[model samples]
Target: MSKQFASAGDMAEKQTSFTEIGDGLWAFTAEGDPNSGVIIGDDSVMVVEAQATPRLARKVIDCVRGVTDKPITHLALTHYHAVRVLGASAYGAPQIIMSEPARAMVAERGKEDWESEFDRFPRLFQGHEEIPGLTWPTTTFKGRMSVYLGRRRVDIMQLGRAHTAGDAVIYVPDANAMFTGDIVEDRSACYCGDGHFHDWPATLERVRRFDLDAIAPGRGGALQGAEAVNRALDSTADFLRSTYRPAARVALRGGSLKEAWDAVRAECDPKFADYAIYEHCLPFNVARAYDEALDIDTPRIWTAARDKAMWDALQGG
Candidate 1:
């Protein structure tokens, strides 16, 4: 099955849904697509993760307007993914926040990632021209930063290297809620293209230690209650374990990329077949897993050319 390239599809036109996770806290979810979180303070608001473009971010702005009139004061980047951070200018947030590692990754590979992602998932980059440029964090922290939302508190912590070197989570102790970037997902495909699979499970375990009543995952609906939170964590861990183990085994045996891909498919497809973006993520996921299992510590840079080449090799050019 040779991989086929299709022209970028139309941008999603559906209205994003905003669900209140707690008092003064909201989650903006669009279908099972990328999600953004909102925290309203006494004086202003902070938006976590800008969508792909200002046009898309304005939709989120509209959602925030429906809730309150407080101006947006902060824009946080969970990581330096093009889809998550490029639309930041839309908020006109004075302080853009991110972990120090995330900022470094942006400085290192942000441009390549921007070009690569736009090619791979153009639909997500609606109003691409609206992107002022790659987003840079005005404020960067080493481990954790406590942000005060008036009296309420939001703790942004860089727990571990999982989804990317700079992955961070926003925890609200008052609300007993956590907003995990791609670090945790509920019934959504894990994009392991730039992930650390072995470390991701342990990182997730760290996240499990939190006493969360609810969670707004990077993708999917807002999980309500402890049971939903646990399910999300367990499912995310399971997805990583299942995909990485088989892919690593085959790669260690000196199997070809296609063989590794087939091995992973046989192991994961039965369970994750119905999950979002499962097919879309498999090739890149297997490639990274294969590399890591061979003791490749860092994820290889993914450019648009490499994406197609890898797809062709694994799927039969």
Candidate 2:
């Protein structure tokens, strides 16, 4: 299998798909693109992971309106990703929430991430000019926060570091469902550019502790049933291990960055070739994994110039 890349034109014309995961809960997906989750409580609504821009977020708003007329009261960011949180302003929710660590990451490297991601995937950043700026959390919690939507309860918890140091998940015990940000991608490749690989598996263990019947992963279709949920979790773990182990091996051998990337690509591309965004994510994933294996604690910031330089160096100019 060969990895398929989405051109900017293809993303521009793509249509988002919204599917009901549970009663009053919807998953807004777009052909393995960025995903958003919606939870409609008795009195109001809570949107999880705003899209890339306000214009894009409006499409999700329209989907929620199709089912309920309740006002959006909160916007929840699963992590500090430009493609995921930049569209938060469109929600107009009084409360925008995130983990404390996530807020810190936004404050530290948010600007560089915005420029890096926009350059990497221009299609997702349509109407990039409409963005007010980096999405800041008006409300932040350290460990966990539980909010009631009338009778419905949504628990947002920072399980551990996975996709990023500030990764979080939204768990609904009533529905036995969990909305895992990028912590666990179903059919899509996990973007581990800023990830903590060693901590990721442990984070997955925390996520599995919940008796979840279904999962709204950050990308791809929602996982339904115990079998499918297990499969998603297993696949995500496998992806991390396969990519990190090989990259780690190459780095330990004192190989060049190109050699490490080739090692990861040889190992992962063969197995995850059919997964969405496999090619787009590999370079960054290998770079971070290489750094981590060499005892680099914090991932380096990815500016637009750095992104092009890395891509050209690895994939050829």
lDDT of each: 0.88, 0.88
My TM-score estimates for the predictions, one after another, are 0.96, 0.95
Q: How far is candidate 2 from the true structure (C-alpha RMSD, Å)?
A: 2.3
lDDT (10s digit) by residue, model 2, range 197-249: 99999999888878688899999898888888989899999999999999999
Off by over 4 Å in 2: 1-12
Query: RMSD to native for every prediction?
Result: 1.5, 2.3
Against the correct fold, how does model 2 do in TM-score? 0.95
lDDT of 1: 0.88
Per-residue error at 60 for model 1, in Å? 0.7
**Candidate 2, clashing residue pairs?**
none
- Per-residue C-alpha lDDT of model 1 across residues 1-317, encoded as one tens digit per residue: 53443324435555567999998889999765789999998888889999888988888999999999988998888999998998899997559999999999999999999999899777787679878798999999999998886787889999999999899999888888888999998888899999999899999999899868889999888998989999999999999999999998988888888888888999999999888667777888999999999999989999999998997787562
TM-score of 1: 0.96
